[model samples]
Target: MLNRMSDHRLAQLNIAALKAPLDDPALADFVALLDPINALAEASPGFVWRYVDENGADATAARPFGDDLIVNFSLWADRDSLWNFTYRSGHLDLLRRRREWFTRMAAAHQVMWWVPAGRIPTIEEAGERLALLRANGPSPEAFTFTDSYPPPSAPPTTAETGTPETATRAGAGLTPPRPASPSSS
Candidate 1:
């Protein structure tokens, strides 16, 4: 069992369904931004680790979910660190433009939980968390930005958690842009 108080970090795993094949020209812009944004995340204050594939690329083609889905699993110092890198960094720009290259997922596409500080989460573990979130909604075990929970040591309170209203307003600037017509080249 992992203990929250003993150097554990927050882990986030998000899966996105591609609107078009990554090589498609319509998604060129999104693909182009990957390197820079990933570099930014790695350099961010709270960043600990990010899953990379055999090609040493960001796990964009890793499809533990399916061939059309991509996974981004990373570890951060804490919730605030992840939040800052995600919302207060260049990552937000890509997030805002996601609809152009990714489909709107009807199910929960993102899930976050805590992990032992240096322990990286396996794809199976990430999948389990995503499933838990999809089936049970937000909980300390697995949650989202809108419905966050505190670490085990902290008391669970609305004030401490990121409620839907607050998350919506705070992340408004990062909302995905309107969908664009799919293109192959």
Candidate 2:
């Protein structure tokens, strides 16, 4: 199903714990590949914005989970746009190589949510979403790619599993006001 909402953009946060510092020889390859991968994301269709450090470099230095963990926070036109870039583009190989440079996170390391277009989510807001995912699993508030959620703007009927029904005034219990025959003199 096309889970992406038209009225909202998708915001995503991916965190990875580093096995070694970026300058370490063991992590050189991973470090070297970051620029290219980031460039690919920027060039991809539907990419909206990405969070960068004050210097405007990659987000690797913006570690919310202390010095060891890194964040990649960005916004896309929708889920499909991010899915295509992360899985279908040339970045796939680099992504698979993550095991070499990053440690396995105990809980979920990625969280995604829908936000109003042109809105930039603060790191604290994203951290809360990540915590929510770790504590509660996949909810509409915060979710993962494998288990995504539609935006709040989705049509009410389609958001849940139910046969579509057209309710009449009688069904809804709102009676029309009785028409006055004529105003009493």
Leading candidate by lDDT: 2
Write candidate 2's Cα lDDT for 27-107 as tens digits: 999888888888899999999988886776668877767898889999999899999999999889988898999999888
Instruction: Report the error of model 2 at residue 62, Å.
Output: 1.5
State every prediction's TM-score relative to the real structure: 0.77, 0.79
Off by over 4 Å in 1: 1-6, 154-185
In the range 59-122, model 1's lDDT, one tens digit per residue, is 8867778999999999898999999999998999999998888999999999999886678888
In model 2, the worst 10-residue window by lDDT is: 162-171
User: What is the model-wide C-alpha lDDT for candidate 2?
Assistant: 0.83
Off by over 4 Å in 2: 1-5, 154-185
Clash counts per candidate, in order, are: 0, 0
List lDDT for all candidates, in order.
0.82, 0.83
